[model samples]
Target: MENDRGTKRSRWRDDDEERQTAERRRQEKERKRKQKQERKEKKQQQLDQNKPDDNGTSEPKETSADVNGLDLDINGLLQFKAPEIRSCRGVNNYEMLNHIEEGSYGVVYRGKNIDTDEIVALKKLKADKNQYGFPITSLREINTLMALQHPNIVNMKEIVVGGSLDQIYIVMEFVEHDLKSLMTDMREPFLQSEIKTLLHQLLSATVLMHENHVIHRDLKSSNLLMNNRGQIKIADFGLARFFSEPSQAMTQLVVTLWYRAPELLLGAKYYSTEIDLWSVGCIFAELITNKPLFEGRSEIDQISKIFDLLGYPDEQNWPGFKSLPHGKTINKPKNYVKTQSLRTKFPMMTSAGIDLLSSLLQLDPKRRMSASEALKHPYFKEDPRLQPPEMFPTFPSKAGQERRRRASPSAPVARHGDHLNDNKNENDDDDDDGFIMAAPEDEKFGLFREQDKKGGGFQLRF
Candidate 1:
């Protein structure tokens, strides 16, 4: 009987302890729920206080009383405000003034901003011909221009669209004259000082491009624009692209035929910024002579012209020359002279200038001068200092009036399989030749007088 009473009392004590633990857990959960509700109410009250009234005005935020009524200064804290969101304006925002010129990627037009009354160059992207969603060349041009913001580079204001998805335009700052057209109209070649100034600007711009890991595949006289103040702006980045170390295999069909590098003609699959330097060298020679250094009719003729001027490449000059895809196909003339003719061609050039030019036009891509190195060349530091842009002579704006006939060949259009097909010859497709019809003899001016029969002066623009 005593053992039974003891067991029953122990059972009752255990039940009482279990009930006490359950009550404590319930109270704790209820307390947490009340705290959460209070926090939500406080947040709602703060948001309601800051909300705008019927008059579109909101109450000033109370920084001192914020954070549990602490006497803290919120001004010292880093506050992040949401960025303002905006929609891309339509092409109607700009009034088309006149058609400027058409390029491989787009058609250019002088436009005026309806609101600001500011003049801008509108480039209508060639999207209608593309079967794909959007043209990669247009995307690259837009992305490159947006990333590269230098004074020498043409400024991209904004991108505007038309009624359909196919109609897209890139808005840029209006530049008065292109170097090619200006040179074509000029009575005489540029002065030594003027050349130095122009080259300095070009090199400066090139340095910025290489530093940013960009290779402008095409850099020629027509692609360079100048304003009334004589400021030169590099334009037309349709062929430009970013590169990395170890190099990449890009299409050999890039760059205009006249300004193309020798390596490109010889089927060099892996090339870098050196190709651009080669174009710069050609531009340099053109600036001095007021004529193209090597004006060839075709790819073979172009290579022959390069060899005639620079001499045949050997192991001593260009190592691994035989390894190039098209190297074995090169046909050397029986009477080919083994001597370089740069010095003979440019007799008036200074020793320093000759050295700089030779370094830039080196047969080996490895030996070509870099933009930074070219900038520091003794040629620039020599006599005939660079002329200031302000001192440059202003010319009548032909681009501002009407569309003038382009003498130079257009840039090679990018094809669908261009990057994928390495074995295909660029010459196989006649459409990619970019040959322009010769202008009428009566329309010939300044530089065309002597070389009218040979061909008109080379000038390209965007």
Candidate 2:
């Protein structure tokens, strides 16, 4: 009986050990999953914070890029095994050279096609699958670029997925410079003509996007591309999306705050292509004033600046002034002390400039000036109407010795299975005057809007 009892105790001890082992494993699994969720949340927050006003601070201003030839790759959270590109169905036979840029996403490398000796900018997603997570941004950028094409729009030659399910790369045209560089290079604020020229082409590009139902939710000077040839092309469509029906107003949180229009600022809903036009108008204002028109720190401050310049909004002026998400806040502009005035702020501007500014600054989106209509505005018909065609960008072949144009603007990206001779030109990629790295562009807007003191009115964004 003693021996049997001892054996039963030993069996119970073995059972307890097994139970402890299983519990340890379950706890470990739970910890790993929680860690992964935390990492994903952190990464998304990083992307959002990259935009200015996120976390209440601004990102470093962009700088000039070397833009030689190389491919940078980014990885996302998904467990993707990169395919072997050395074989079929890969972005092979391309040589990556120098580093062009490092943005919030990843590094961009300049590349040359081995088959035809053609040049391109290859973007590789950066991040580890296990650590930094996946490259949702690369996919978003590429997806938007694939279906879009226009004179004033940047073009994506191809998107390559390669390397054992781990390394993926996207190949695209390497633009020489963005408008931010142009703004930097010019000592003087862009001439009215230049603003007109840029706006006209931008309008053409936006019109194309609208036709295709793509909304470039993010439009800014930095997003505009310029080559030595004087041409400007719109780039960066990752933030853009299709304009679905009902036009449910997207997050007023898309474009850089300075370039954000009034309706978006007022938290207006039901946005459309009209929003893009508002941005265009703001860009025009910035180009001439060398400053933003309606700059505000917080949403309330931003709307206040607009009201001070454009005057207070009565339900009479903007039928539904009191119906928006935060309509009541704008009810009292004269009460706390309105800030400065846009006119006095930009003392150098002419009366005509003021007229144009007010027109674009209108509270109501419907009453806002349309691109086509603005193009014909008398304000632009001045001594030097928008930059003359001769002064703006021309075909790649005509871009001159500085910019190496291997083909005509109309040339095909591929010839007989070779992508080496894509007719493309690189903009000399630097600008000194775009936005002073000293302060953010939005801050500049606030300064200008607060320059002079105008009373009894306020600018309403919605």
Candidate 3:
């Protein structure tokens, strides 16, 4: 009877132990499931916060990443490294050569790839930090350049990062000289045929940008780069962006003062590709006359300068004239006295060229010539037609550059019916203020000198 009682007690103990083991396992499974659910929720929150709202449009949504405010951790974001720039510290990868140019964005240097023995332009971006880590300008430039591939657009080979975020380098295809530098170096003004070729290339590139839904906010002679083969590539896209939707608002403060459009000067909140067309018009005039079309000292003066040449925008000229942001406030009396005939100003231009210019500089943004339309203009299809890049005249090197510069006379002073006067100054390059966003001019009387040498007497700007 004692043996039977002991056996019952042993069986009860075994059942209790088994039950405890099952309970512990159930508790462990419940904890793991809860942890997994929490992790999934956290991941979804991150994705939702980062992704932009899809409003059912084909246009690339302006995300936080596109603008500023990206939390950039080089360590985490350094997942992408170009094979050419794999080695850091500038030793094994690239050998830094001469410093080329320094602009608002960064200092550009000529560099060589150690591995491939290729020359490249290394643009070191200025890492100015706001609440957002890096400047939106840099981000916009990087993203835009990466997406673009054109003969007339600067080619960005790859990116090189250093130990810190500040040491970022944009590897770009190296070109011999910028238009500004080349203009200064040239011994003669560009030939009529040469000008046509240059304009064709420029407009071609502009068409590519518009087709790709990009807008180059800053278009100036300084930003146009050219190689020895007469290939013109548009560079300096610090202010460029993918075209914004009509409903979205963008900053009006863009483009250099001399190249800024009338609508921007009037504080238009929403602008389109027409702004770039206006800039191209200004550049076109500059190339022909060897001087800026409208040189304004301030925002107000800039508007006045435009009116002085093109007449003020009234309801007749611009449909929603008074409705613009500062349209009514700053719309002073148009300087009808300074309004001269473009034909009279550019006596050398063909009728077709004049027509194209008028279309581009139309007061109504709606009427402004688009890149595509401009490319199709009769000017390009004229008798001489556009010449290939290879046919353009070659410029002499430094040995003869100074003589060429000295030989060309400053363009005659032609402001408000001024007489032709000879002004001789060799180092008479436009003030550095020409590069500034709000470039101011000291003189109201304007003169234009042809760029470079052989085309004529002292190329002059008054």
RMSD of 1: 16.5
User: Per-residue lDDT for 1-462 in model 2, tens only?
Assistant: 236557435677779999999999999999999888976875566576466774678784322211333222222332434856664346677877777666666666777889988887777666656765565656667777877877678887766666755556677666777666555544345544556677678777877887778788788887887764666788766678777766865676777777777777777766887778767877777776565666778877877667776667777767786777766666653455545555776665557766666666667877776656665667666544565656553323211114443434553233334444334446633331123213234443323322332111223211
In every candidate, how many clashes are there? 1, 60, 17
Give the least accurate 10-residue stretch of model 1, judged by summed lDDT. Answer: 444-453
The weakest ten consecutive residues by lDDT in model 2 span 453-462
lDDT of 1 by residue, 273-327 (tens): 9999999999999888778878999999998888888988888889888889998
| Model 2 lDDT on a 0 to 1 scale | 0.64
The C-alpha local distance difference test score for the whole of candidate 3 amounts to 0.75
* Candidate 1: stretches off by over 4 Å: 1-85, 331-335, 402-462
Instruction: Give the number of the best model, judged by lDDT.
Output: 1
Against the true structure, whose TM-score is highest?
1
Off by over 4 Å in 2: 1-92, 125-140, 164-166, 335-356, 389-462
Which stretches of candidate 3 lie above 4 Å from their native place?
A: 1-92, 129-132, 330-339, 396-462
